[model samples]
Target: MTDAPTLHFGVFEVAAPQVGGTFSWAHPRSRSADFLDPQHWIHIARVLEDSGFDFLFFAGGYGYPLVDGDLPEIAATKGINFSAIDPDYLIPVLAQHTDTLGFVVTLSTGLEHPAQLARRLASLDHLTSGRVGWNIVTGASQNAVADVFGQDAIVPHDTRYAMAAEYVELAARLWEHGWDDDARVVDRESGVYARRDGVRPVVFEGEHYRSRGYFGAPPSPQRTPVLFQAGTSPAGRAFAARNSECVFVQATTPARTAAAVADIRALAAERGRDPRGMKLMAGLTVFVGETEEEARRYEAEFDAMQTDEIVASLYAGNTGIDLLALDPDKTLHQVLGQGSVGEMGTSNIDRFLGENAPTVREILDQLKGRGTRGFRLVGDGTQVADGIERLAAETDLDGFLIEPVFEPADLEDFGRLVMPILRERGRLREGAPGNTLRARLTEQPGNDRLGDAHPVLAAD
Candidate 1:
């Protein structure tokens, strides 16, 4: 009944202050809001569900943003951190409140064994009554490696993806092929409810990890939980195209977004997948009001609340460049060569800002365009919906990974005002929630495991 194409919208959990633009932590002075308070998140999630969101993603990492080798400036401003509230456990709390709101939790293949991660995610799926997703990440920063594994040697870029490939495959085996439909039944009469022959043991021994035998639990609603991928370097894109059901893309322009979507879809086609099956969700932030001028006024107010020094500090940590040490005029080309290359993709410093270093005043405004790797829409409800629709239509993106520009209120507006328009247009999911994250986002069959198009689906 709507004109918009089938797309599912999900909220991208912002770690601190402003949802879209980098804001302060819960308390800038004390930073003390407990990350596990389900009440706080429930307020956000309920708005999303009422406003028509398909899911809400809780994203985090083990370490802080160590981009350019500095944290003091970022820390003082209470900008984003390398550490986040452990969020997997929050799923049950969130599920206890809402029925259709799916949860996506980030865990990397580089850190743990497939058995442990698979069982954990499966348990979440079980506890959440089947509304859960697993975001597959390769370690983005070495800090996490040092912190989690107590090893300082970050794996090489290509090697990280290589290990991820193996990790994802092993997970598929444990979740998909390990059990049959009738593996568990707590019946008292026959005394034997489980069919032993039906539950198969998966034996995997690769260069990185090896697994022997069946998984610990019976299948959850979504066995492999929808696999979400977020990297887009050449190797990164390849990994996503092969294993990912949902792709989170960050970019600055609608044109760039269109190209990225086409690029990934082409890669999927080369792998013999129906390119349409891959859902490309781009980053976005919004400010809304009864009128356009009012929305503009709101953005200016939020921008005033932002501390540029703190923003730069986060930029420094994320890039590993020690921004304070260099004069703003110093070129990025020079700084990167001088051992400032301790981090991963600094798209803020690389693609958008493009110079090694620019003066604060001249560069700070420029930094806004690339923060989340997508266009940040600022306007009233109608205008905001107009822009989102434009981005989706022009770029051919499936939907958005919405970030809040002003914490709870920013999210509140999107759900209240913009979402209905999108839902009316068919730009957001118009259907009832599915049993699993995969089924909710995709129209394809609910496999409860990796589909045949995924590389992991063929490894056995």
Candidate 2:
């Protein structure tokens, strides 16, 4: 029999009261209201670490879904995607309590300067003991970005990727080349803290960004903190192939995901990168129970919390299309022909426009919870593991980023019910104490640093 493929696991979270489902906070079992308490996050980190999760991935950006320059009723009143605190501040505290778990925090290339962003990330690497990763994003919604950040003009879609390419290059240079590995001497007898010759300024000039000065910090472990990118558009895919160590994709279907996976690997090969070096993780949500019937019951309960009206409004803010105002029976093809989608999320829109174009009502039901987009499995522990194994095999995916339907309870259930089954099958990594986040995620034993093939290490 062929050996089972090893898969990494992570939790997809936002720093908010509710993440995956609308009104998920209303669930009797949910403790999402405790998000503000440091203990809440600390308990979560401990649970995940004990459960053998590879990392905690925080989804972030400044933009909320807006329609006609106003927040939708569900978004405004129910706090759907509205109460996000910056996960950056919360990481240090979580790091203090956990020993092996990694944290990947999202920061936009659109909002912060590359130099400052690099410094902050490097500091996080040090604080977390090299258990840090960065989810680099070009703002998904340009209108929302402009509204929230008070920008005078919107940067076009492709142009944002262009700027991100420049931004990432500069930041990587600072992380990889600014200071020599042995630069810090701390020679008390000689009164020389660092070797002056070992440190040098990283002078970079590009169309979108420029930097001239030595990086403010010395090298941390895994100097370039595992670079992660989540764009699946053409420009986004190209960017991921060139720069990302891990790529996050939201799966539309098994066949489509397989195609995307092949395309990304092919793109990497064309760029002179080892195709296997890039890890692709898809967003997946699992509803598990002791029996299949119980699992279905749980799924139905969550589904019942969604209302068509609220979901329709939330979809409008995400896609820049007011679907609620349209004919309920109109097909997505008809809707798309009516107007340009402009700068909102094309990825979400494309999901509905597939071969079997869904109607407005169908679209609303599918998007009942904003982040609940990918493959959703409802089953008992063994059955759920089988589904995950099959999905990974079919799609050539490296891992799954679990989107919790309810915060701590959902995670606890997965850990208690499903994790052991996978572990016994040798489908998950064994304990690797003292491993850097990169090493853990990539399953590269003892090597915490980026490989020689990475663009960041290429000679200028």
Candidate 3:
């Protein structure tokens, strides 16, 4: 049962650079393209599609909430940092150009009305030809709160998940309940665009939001975008167990990752879910070369290339603690704080990073590999493949979100060089390309819709 556990080879689309968005290796020497150059995505989409990648996602967050306490450096480097043409807009451009690549976009449940999310995501699925996926994220950063809601206001962690529960409930209803499969009958004789009896509005009234549903336009190929969640907290994990078709996790050690995987699957079982159906993806970064010596040199190049201040800003932004103010070696708990690490209670990653509390230099070294605060893998193709396989063997993860060090080339190398090994070893997903994101992922039809065990479905 564990063989070929469905690897989702993907790349994070944020254009990460050095401090306050200092300078990134991705675009350090080249002319910056519009939206970091169309070529950047074009190459990315093409490579991921050809390499048997399950999807390529663009992560989103609201506002540039700079954490430096002084926002100027972040402000100045905004163009260079991860500034983009927006993931929603980018998905379509890539969709027209690529065949099998799925595109996932991150959307915050906290800020959107369910009706709007439903409509937008459904339209995206149609536009992308059933290859769209939605990453349900509750806002994490305090600055996101200030930008999306207002200054000095933040919701507690559990409550946000509570709101998230309702948000997803409403969204699922909109996407799944509104259109029955038989709704679209184009009999030339009747010539009606849609059957009214087969289609009806979905309604939701809840504590967080209330919507009198207007059935969002015509149903697309897959009405609901593939469900995904990345929160690792108890509340977040519970949410993933119930709703997520795929889950994202991060950890430094194989032991930590293995423990996390067990916890999530346990909760999914506790909730009476088919734990096997939920594919878990660990976020990872890989720096590869033809030989081990070459790989070491490449790591040195990336190490030499980094600017300390930028790494500091990236850390500050993620931890929500001003790096300038804290003792580099001290635990965040030692300093103690008011809100969650993601604006809730302390986060798992924060605690994990805090364990032994590596100094500033160590944290930077770790991050240089994954870009964000996730796992790092560095080696040649054989070593890289072995490392990924070992992570799967040790942690029991379904697959991973492979964050890239360089643009098209890194992804190109993986799909071209690395993925085949995964496939040959049967560590990756197999079979013909699927139509909908969920179908490709789960390999089951109708399962695209939320099952009865889900809390939202129960309410319905």
Which candidate number would show the highest lDDT if scored against the true structure? 2
Give the best candidate by TM-score.
2
Clash count (model 1, backbone only): 20
Superposed on all Cα atoms, model 2 deviates from the true structure by an RMSD in Å of 1.9
TM of each candidate vs. truth: 0.90, 0.95, 0.89
* Candidate 1, superposed: residue stretches over 4 Å from native: 14-21, 24-36, 67-70, 76-79, 144-148, 337-343, 346-363, 368-370, 431-434, 444-448
lDDT of 3 at 458: 72
lDDT (tens digit, per residue) of candidate 1 on 152-243: 56566677788889999988888888888678876789898788888888998888889888787789888778889886667778888898
- Whole-model lDDT per candidate: 0.71, 0.83, 0.69
User: Can you tell me which runs of candidate 3 are displaced by over 4 Å?
Assistant: 1-4, 15-23, 26-35, 68-75, 78-82, 148-152, 339-349, 352-371, 430-434, 445-448
TM accuracy, model 1: 0.90
Q: lDDT at 192 for candidate 3?
A: 79
lDDT of 3 at 327: 65
> Per-residue lDDT for 1-460 in model 3, tens only?
3455556666666533322233445544322233455666777788777778888877776544356444537434533244444568777778888877888988989876888888888889888878888899887454645654666666777888889988998888777777878888888887876788888877777898887756755777777788888877778888898788889876658897788788999988887777887888887767677777776766666556566555555555555655446566655554455443556423534554544776645555555433354676778888989898888888898888876555555566667667877778766664244467777787664445555566557752
